[model samples]
Target: MPANEKLKEKISHLPHKPGIYKFFDDNGIIYVGKAVDIRKRVSSYFNRSAQHNKKTLKLVSQIKDIEFTIVDTEADAFLLENNLIKQYQPKYNILLKDGKTYPYICIVNERFPRVISTRNKKNDGSRYFGPYPSGTTMHVVLDLIRTLYPLRTCTYNLTPENIAAGKFKVCLEYHIGNCKGPCEALVDEAEYNANIAQIKNILSGNLSVAKAYFKEHMAAAAADYQYELAHKFKQKLDMLEDFQAKSTVVSNTLTNIDVFTITSNEQCAFINYLKVMNGSIILTQSLELEKKLDEDDTDILASVIVQLRQEFESTSREVITNIELRLPLDNVTITYPQIGDKKKLLSLSLKNALYLRKEREGRQEKNKEMSEQRELRVLETLKKDLRLTELPRQIECFDNSNFQGDNPVASMVCFKNGKPSKKDYRHYNIKTVVGPNDFESMYEIVTRRYRRLLDENQPLPQLIIIDGGKGQLGMAVKALRDLNIYGKIAVVGIAKRLEEIFYPGDSLPLYIDKKSESLKLIQRLRNEAHRFAITFHRSKRDAGTLKTELTDIKGIGLSTADALLQKFRSVKKLKDLTLDELAAEIGKAKASILYAHLHPAEGENA
Candidate 1:
């Protein structure tokens, strides 16, 4: 295996320190690797005595150049290699096939921190918890937090100066006891942060701390003879216990450890991770890697261990895996249990990995069949992108149109199985809202549309799209909340400016790829809604103008004006008609009055 002279010279000068190395071909970098001894590692690839696998032989054959970055330690090298593999996505590195950004519970860094679910983890100093593998589990944790301790959900800047200056008011959440009135300074900063601290503990898998806090408060309230306050604390404690019990408890002995397992075929590998806290599984995640080389399970698992631990920020000292792998994690103990509670935990993790592999295989089969129907494939894409529990077979989008508050109207366009269901489309004349209030108009139309569906026992749409920003979307959420059907169906708002998708209660908007089919489908629905609303609004405005012009005449009334407009489509066309032409369509008296109103100069001349 003789390398090029230039490559040989470059490899000869490689550092002996721990670092990452890259192999570049004519096109670009094809592989990235980490090594404790960079010189030794790169030299092994070109040694004629060492037999190499097919993938490695092919990779080494294309090596036109080599680059290396020296780092402080082996751990740093591993981290850099993983990051480069993700960034450049070198051809020969293990490919993470999921291509998904797992959701994390973000505690926004602000005066009044918002606890919300976000897929993005930023470095702005706010705490993030759980790149949760399951959205439902993350939501359940979030719901429990909100239930036990009321936090502000509104994206209000509740600074000290703003609160003192009376710049904000308590919202409906405050009235409903879902938020303490922190905006108006009714809740002190210290007390609010105390709740945040407990929230952090809970999210960090220290449920015992939260339970103890509630118990201590409950005891104090009871000692003060405040039965109601004591009862509230007791309820919170009970909820915490219930939540804890629901989590899988693999063992009472194995505390604060991580369990990992891996399974693979020739093409790809699957790895499952379990974060165990106090002998209970707090988090479960599975990852898939496409094997470009003949990498063993030990190497794949070791890479995933570093990646997942860094992602989830696990500081557990002990890690139990199904296979043995030596890693350079500081102060961490890696163990492979043969039999015991640790073995059961390992078995549980392996089960999840196998299940994920099975699910992916089945999905691939289903996707092949789905390719036959483009609509189904698009719907599948949408379902995955939006994290919807079910396919959006039926989607309805709403848009409102008005010109300076007159003749306001709204249109609801329905798409069934990725195609317009024209018969299911609807138009609404603004009934409740007085002026050009898009938010209220959206609320009214959404309410009216769904209420009618509910009344008639018709099936509701799987998803609702509001063709506006967060304001309009929030109002729709309020309407659904009032109707007690807020979470029954999935809904999002799409802003036209950037095509930002706003989920209910999420302050941050999701920006889908500009070229994605899901976004294209959403945009089509939005455009259709806008076009429908604009057309209806134009008709209404024309009708209103025609009526006003004709009724201004002495003898004309509502029915007569309608009759004249019905006979002739627009006021412009009616004005162009002769008086005899108008009289032929309507009665002589009303027609003459309308003709006079239309042609005032002609009336005076006659």
Candidate 2:
């Protein structure tokens, strides 16, 4: 059957239910998508009457087969699609490259739970809250918790058996009143757990519960005529109110709503999510997604809503967004407010997204400018050091490589404005030299390089560096003299022993300051030339070895052997690999052929 007919038949049989669908060719999955109606969405790709973009058309043409999973709702489909995309990383999916991990407040799961800030979220039965965007805000909340409840900050095991056996002592934290001496059994477990319960309430944005607990205690202290204790409780209550006042409250009536807004350019989309609880903005997160196709802001926003909400474990009944999104969420209200506080919330979220975009762009621009300025400064310093009439904006360094006078090769590395211009780099095999003649090889390559440049009417480099002492520099100068361009370009040679610089027709070597930028740049050019030459020489030698050994195996071509050598570096290394490891690099069929040839004893058993 034809590939298109096979795909069409598969799409025709899809059920009309909400689910995620995957498009695949012979290699693997290429695209993953979520839709409310699987049959309609899959058939739309094959519908000739509908207008489709070039990318969509290309995707449809390449899809040879289709597979889908039925789900109960669109929300479930979104979740499944997100997970599949992450697992497979299909070629045509909007990549959500998550940023750095934010700090979460963790309540340690132990006999006496300790509250602390952590960046790692492990599933160890411990509770985590507030991947706070602002470290300052998180620290402030931590301080409030510490002042309200004097929990232990130490990591002592604090097991019931250890505490009962008196295996621990009170630390300085207990003396400083930051801890209630839980390690020494001075604080009862039930009372300590009660304080932990209240701390949980405060961290969850339920400050009213904590406040009520403090107020009731204050009243009890006043009834017992303990004025000083009651005064301390009053101070705690006042601190709670002050903290609440500092929070950015949207409105007293609004509760348990999430606001999401999107700002995008041609390449990427930035979405900001704000979680509002009890009329105050409690959490804020911004996500950056790299676009794969021509998806509009509304579609991207809808997908991101599912992603961020699931990550933050948001259970808000209402979702407010800047654009109109028709997600089939059960009993959930999607609002696009026009003229109310909800509108302001949406605007605030949009402002955040725009600010994030502007900040990222501005940072990139500033870094580019700084890099250009630094490069210009380095070039100027190098010009002064070399005493050249013109700045060496283009510098070329050459080095020759050989192993016991075999597989001789030469490499030329170019640096433009004090940075490596890899596109201008070139490698050469020795054509005229017989064996291990560095001087003659240098002369041949130098003459050939400049002769071709002159023949092609290409620009010449301002400075040339030879990676050896006076002998190599003299050969390069002889080559230029033969070409009648000896006085046109400046040439120098560097000695590896002392990093001494040799000029043409000079007897003595010049030494610049050890820490000078000019010296560093010269050293960088010399090292890069040596590395390039050695790499080329090894590749040539490895190719010869593979031709003698690996080519003996049937169905293994030079390209495959070269690829294997480039990765594992040698036949010994490749021989040690399992069949599965080889399959991962090359295909299973080729891997089996090679593995069987390499390990004939093991192959016979199989």
Candidate 3:
């Protein structure tokens, strides 16, 4: 637990930047701190000649792992650190809890609603845009809106009657061309309201609507022969395009999406959430969770989505993750993006998850042991980790294998006491599920495997590993439910992304420590199942190709195919068959047809 040679070596990767760094014990969060220079500040804790402080020394002694988040600036780090420390309430930080709040952009309630940033949300009929990631983001957005719109940023109430009577005077904003003198009726309410409508669309992550509105106005003005008006609308469209060109990525249509990634140790899970609006990341943060069971990555991400959406008051219905998540949330579309900006967001979340996992796992190396004691330990850990009534000494992991909807197959590999029990491995040629539907393939295999086991009075595995996230796991669970054996054995899904452990009927995935034996055992079983499935699939394909002579021949069906195979098993043997020999088994006409099909040059010469 001390900052020894290993800790010294690990800290070398720490960058010189403003960010939040965390120290942890074997169990959970212990301390969180922010630094202007994270490496220098963290490096000071292990300095030999540093001032002897009782509390600091005690905190350093229990440091088993380290993790951090890098930010753009010191102020962002400060805010993030404060946000995290307050959220986690780490042991080594200040205990004051009163000074905690994040910034939100508020559109003030008035005739010309003044768009401004505020920490407080008021219920005065004004619309609010964000709890943006940082103040810098809020200011940038505010500047963009102001530049695009000529709305008055003043305190005056520009009522229709007041404007008609000319009760208000032109201000500095009007003189500077920032406002259209709405106070003096120089700009009508209809025009000002149109601008407000466009601003609302932009704030609501509907830039496409705003852009279309401008383009429509431009087209209409041109059609009416109003060259001057058309030029003004063209100018607005050009300005909007120029603003969009500076965006992180604005060429894509993806908007109003949330991305999440999860990483875990045996004790805790770290989940990162990103909110994207119009191809721009508006808010992002990573949070931790204490695992109560063998939770999977899908479960952890699902729970994190619910918690973070509530925390940030976000209503984004589209969520992108590396794995498809089946969440309890209604009207939310959870997609696994294979490409585009959404994929980038998913990758970003995964990168954060991996970084956190590396920080936690860098301190320990797996002890490869095969003793009876080690076997018992793995079983005991498995039982406890899964909260199972029986030890998972007998484990079966299932994986579905397919290549572009061909030769769909499933494989089940058995493991006893954390080691492969290859004698009981099973392979299944998919019968029920057509094409490359993995979930249905999994369902078909699970039903067939367990049904046969029950019929033959064979022992069922104490655990069943679904080599996927929630979807395939759900199919297995459904199979268990169909057989009326839903809860008799422990079942969990291991996702390839973030190595997340998912439990059925849970929202969050149980993130096990990367070095934990239970995860290692699960990973082994998963790999073995995948390997067996792939090998079987490849063998099936190879056998099919090898015996393709009968199948490739013209007018040869399975029945006749068997006849030809029974006579001449190989293509070379069939090629050597004379017309008279083929006619003995097949009809003379069929024999001639086969000869012409197989021997094209000889048929032509004859």
Candidate 4:
């Protein structure tokens, strides 16, 4: 295929699917990448303004053909991409090379199988327990199982025919009582299988079955006056409890999992992997990835899981991530532990990822020439995160405040280059709409604010933020549309619930990363607008109350009210005055009426 036509065809056919894409040439796959949208990411490479590095440009030049594998999830794509990259050793991809594999506990399939740890888990007839994060703790579990149960440690097959022929002899393991000497027919198959069953339960982190069995036997023995056997059962149960107490962190019930966390900046992502075995962290390691594209947390995490598992040789079948991750592992279970020991492990993993991110950022800051880079990075991130056409250098936020259908007011706060511009701050009194109509109040203020700006030829903000949800945002958008600035000005609403960002005419909220500076800036704007509106509303309410306050008293006209206000200056001071004291200021008849009105409960004083 001709290069231009092939490129066009590939670009046109790219689907908005989550998967891994490979760039191939005469030399084979030169680059492999995973994307939530294959079309977007791939087409971005072809855009002349994508600002490709020299290495990337050279790689793109060598691309003769493109191939892709669509997967069920971003995580599946991540794993597949990692595998393909490792298999082909793609030159354009950054490899996190490590030589260790995670270990798993295997119960060998036999008439009387042995429990042991191995690097690989094969699907023979045997039961496999782990791809444990920590080999050391798994080792302890194996030892604990051996300590609790008397299973054979011999190499002899101990077949039934051989035992019947009396061909096998007891070994040192039998002499030491580590084995029940099944080779010599001292132990039968049913007794050996029972011990194996209990071991399987323990290895799977379910001690209840074994504990229940032991307690049942102990109670029955005690009922029969078999004190020695009952005491032995009690000792075994106590031993199991002690072992579980030492290994378990949050709860004794949680076990056999790997916890993962991810933290990142614009340039890189730091992933922390926690090897959780038997509800305890056995080992932890943080790996850093330099981002070639702007990938989200799931993308970064999914890719890292495959690489981390492959690099560390992890055999764990259960994965606990700080956030939800859907991977296509039929044998593996994925979870987002919100509480208990698993939650704590997830948090610890997050802490590690955060620490690594901070350390790397600190190192980078030291090497850089200016701190303004941080500010630029924030602006760029804010732009991308909010999906703005340009940087939000100038932003205006609006809020409405009212109390019990009285004194409705609105406030607009302006932020320029991420700092509050108090000079441009505005407050509006609701004139067009009566009662506590928040949506209409928002419309009035938004229309008045922007219309005035237009009339006066004042510079309008690049962004308008409404301190509300979809309803208020639509009202504001209507105001803009009436002014013919609907599409010209970028307007959005920030709902207090979930800090959701809602666009005009859209019910689905856009959730930015909670830790994102863009979201923080939006939150700050919303809060500032709220504070400004509340302050305005309070002052307006107080003024309205005071204006009619004196007139409300009986026989007090405007003149009398003005006379009393002038004499006392404050209504509170006038209310405190006795009839005699008030009589000195205004005559006794007026004083009696004023005092009577002020002290409604004290009719005797009137």
Candidate 5:
């Protein structure tokens, strides 16, 4: 087929809506590009441009065909483009590789759903909230959910047998009353379901109902002469009220509607969607794109309206009643409701979108400024604290863990330009260290990490951070010196509390200015490293304790064990299956054996 004809054929299927498109070679090699109207964007390639760069001309020439995804808005298109380019590493795209996945809060669908941090959103029965601006923001919401709701975070399936056998114990969350101990049968199913209902209500911004219920409970407790219980209920009620006050209400115009606004500049576009349910703002979402706008504001608004209407048709119960845009939306009833609640809601959403755009721009500027400021501060602080000559652009931190010096493990986390470079994070199972020998463990970890770097001719870090005092710092320094890398890498240590910063040879630790941004950056990095190390350690510990009832089944070998575990993440889930269900899930013979073990009455043994 002729190239232009082939391109036209590809463009024929493209939606005349807002989205980004990609150009690919015959070998499926990608060249990323963005456009508000994908059909127009891809069609532009066929246009003869005299000023085209050699690379661009070459890319355009080799482009076998183009593929486009229709997005709700141009902003959504941009974000999708960024995500795809990051994933595919297209040859012709400007690749700024950052090893960070946008964080999402996934509420897993199960008997008792868990709210946890995830990077991937699959078509599972779960609801995902975010692409949070930062981990801190995600954590704050997660923490609030944990505190406010009696929800289970455990992946363990709760069953009657498990509760009776005491196989499922009350977790720390239960002790603190964050969980209602459903696993242990301490809370009835009705009450637990009620709690879940309240959580959903809270998430949907029905704060008044939750607050009112708590107040009623508080009054009842007070009348019943239970002052402590009454006080607790009152405290909870107060917290809900405070949360309601802080929330910026976006709409009172209508319930169950989403308002979308798109703002575009030459370099990037921003699309913000505010979800209004029951006349209150439930959630707000924003997307940033790398598409340039060519059309007038009204035209852009029209494109957004068409695309959004399509996307919403699949999810929303009814068609959108109205669209409020910066410019006139021709087909829709584009009434800028003046002087009432509807106006206030529209104004709030627009303001939010603009504020978010400015904030994002400001953050980029601040990150650049802070990077330079931090470089100087790190250098000056390292000079005084660790006797280093310059600031470190890259810092690698090492942490070691062992349970009473058994199954010793170590991890190395990296920070580049004051942000975590997760791609460089490394883990080690300590081979050389004995029980309680943290100093030796530190040495082993450092030496192994740097030795590999040396073998690969990789760049050495400007500074090495150990999660210990002078002794641990000294161990790391000695390891570097042994590798003849001591001068190349400045070594420092961070001790807990007193926030003491230790150096290799210094007897006393140094302290940075409490309010310094550099110090805050270091603290954040240090805490993340510690958290990662602890998580790894706990996972190792859990793996060691992993037991399966399926092990008793005669025919169930390693492969079968793996299959069963994959099908059912926990033994409780496996135990929940009947003989027929097991047969459906696995196979007949395997199910027979499992049934014999679980329900002997239904087995051949009976």
Candidate 6:
């Protein structure tokens, strides 16, 4: 059958039930679409008068084949459509790219396991809590868990050999009462597992039960005359109580659902989702995408449903029934429930979404205005401060750092329109110059960075900023001139004490007008570059320290050190291994003698 005839036959077979349908081209590129009535939705496309937009028209023309899944209801269709779109990443669909899976608190299925944040959510007999908004939030919660439970966070495998060798010792966390020190066998397995169960309860919102258990344990410790243990439990109980007091309370009437609201401007549309779980507002995610509307709200809602379902599929609860949209759901039950907490939650979510949309729009406008004002101010300031010929739109700042001239490094941070262009940030390791010669290092770094830019056919920055006055700027200018790239780039220097700005040709220091936003922005960019350079330098110094310790060994070089560290994970782990094992891991011939020093029981002479 011909492609158009196949699509027509499939459309004829589509049911009147609420569901999602997909259109595929000759190349098998799928375009996902949702509808309240699949028959009506699919049939409308065959009508030329109904085609309102270029995209829709294009979609109609490309429909070589059609397919759909029958849904129980419109709500199910809305959800299932999202899942398919996310899975398929249909070429025509507006995809929301989810970066990393959000962190979730996991209680591992071990006798003395720890509470930790994991991206992977598996049904491995361990209870999981969250899909927390961010890693920082997860870290904060993990810290609180440690404070409350005092469970061992270590991944120390409980093997017979390690136990017999007395290799396990109580860590600082245990000594400080943040952990119960299971590695040293200070706590029995049953007791540890019981603690984990209590933690799971606390995380799952049964805080009252968790608190009662803690209190009972504290009383038992006190009765046994274990004052130290009693005091530790008391502290944990107090912290949990404090946390409960501060957390927001929700009404019992609200159900788990996601409420969506959309607001649009000329250029883009903002779609916000308010995720409510167990009557509490857990998170809000807003997506800004290209606007396309010619008065079909159902079509818009359909598009959003297709887009959003993919986002919520992985971690959100399966009990989601309510989805409040700006548009009517037609045959799908997009309920605007009147009266009760569900209605109130939906109202609040919609209001928040609209407010946020307006706020973001306002901020963008304000930022544009601020950028213009700052640019004019920077021009005036530059004319006065550096006595420049004209206002430089593109200013480049350079800073260098080193350890007593050892492991020298530099970084270039760029600023355009009074904002840092972090994409333009570049790093350099000082290869030619040695020891405390800041000017030479600057010249070399700047030359190399710009030379590569030139080779790549990239435009030169209008202004150059150096960390020091006159001498540094002059050296940079000289290097530029030597490379026949001098006049195209202007050089400025910012000094430490007076925060004075200097130009390449001029000997005197210059200062910007006080409290200028442009000056603040430039300083921030320069400081960021300085920080980047110093951080890189410190990492190099640390690596050098490691090399000094390990590289002298016959088989150990930089690559070998890296391999050992990658395999063992830490210096402590590397130290714990016998020399023969390390040699075997790295395939080194000096294994036997190294084993003698590390494990004298082997009897080979070091």
What's the lDDT for all of these models?
Answer: 0.88, 0.88, 0.78, 0.81, 0.69, 0.71
lDDT at 387, model 3: 76
Estimate, for each residue in 436-477, the C-alpha lDDT of model 3 and write its tens digit.
899998889999999999899988888898999999899999
What 10-residue stretch in candidate 3 is worst by lDDT?
A: 361-370
TM-score for all predictions? 0.56, 0.68, 0.40, 0.50, 0.43, 0.51
Q: Kindly indicate the candidate among 2 and 5 with the higher lDDT.
A: 2
- Candidate 1 lDDT over 288-323, as tens digits, reads 788888898988888888878877789999999988
Compared with the true structure, the alpha-carbon lDDT of candidate 1 equals 0.88
Tens digits of per-residue lDDT, candidate 6, 26-66, equal: 58746776677999988888865464577677767777778
The number of the candidate with the highest TM-score is 2
Which is better, 1 or 5, measured by TM-score?
A: 1
Give the Å error, residue 583, model 2.
Answer: 18
lDDT of 2 by residue, 1-606 (tens): 334555777778899999999999768999999999999988887886258777778887778689999999888897789889778878888866455576889999998899999989999999998778767778999999999888898888988889999999998889988899989899999999999998888888888898998899899999999989999999999999998888778988898999999989877898999999999888888877777767899888877777677667788999999888786666779998998899999999999999999988888789999998998888888888888888889999999999999889999999998999999999999999999999999999999999999999999999999999999999999999999999898899999999999988779899888898888999999999999999999989887777668777889888887777766667776787778878878889999998888898986787
Worst 10 residues of 1 by lDDT: 1-10
**Backbone-clash count (model 4):** 6
| Per-residue alpha-carbon lDDT of candidate 5 for residues 1-606, written as tens digits (9 for 90 to 100) | 334665777777787788777777858856766667777767666665565656567777888767777778666665576667667877766443445566677778777677788877778888776555467767766777677677887888776777788888788988986788888888888777676667667665576677878889999999999999999888888777666655555544565655666666655556665556666554555655553223334444444444344332213332221244432222334455666666666666677667778988899889989877866666566455555676677888888777765567888889876668999998888887668898988889889998999999998888877888878888888888999978777777888787788866768778878876656766777777778888788776654433345665687766777676654556666666667777776689987877677666556544
Q: How high is the lDDT of residue 331 in model 1?
A: 91
* Worst-scoring 10-residue span by lDDT in model 5: 312-321
TM-score winner between candidates 2 and 4:
2
Residue pairs with clashing backbones, model 2: none
lDDT of 5: 0.69
Local lDDT at 103 for model 6: 79
Sort order, TM-score high to low: 2, 1, 6, 4, 5, 3
> Each candidate: how many clashes?
0, 0, 18, 6, 1, 1
**Better model by lDDT: candidate 1 vs candidate 6:** 1
- Candidates arranged by lDDT, highest first: 1, 2, 4, 3, 6, 5
Residue runs of model 1 more than 4 Å from their true location after superposition = 1-3, 12-18, 48-50, 70-73, 97-99, 219-230, 358-606
How far does residue 226 in candidate 2 sit from its true spot (Å)?
9.9
Query: In angstroms, how far off is 62's CA in candidate 4?
Result: 5.1
Off by over 4 Å in 4: 1-19, 35-37, 51-64, 69-83, 89-91, 94-97, 219-232, 251-258, 265-268, 273-296, 306-345, 355-606
Model 6, position 252, has a per-residue lDDT of 59
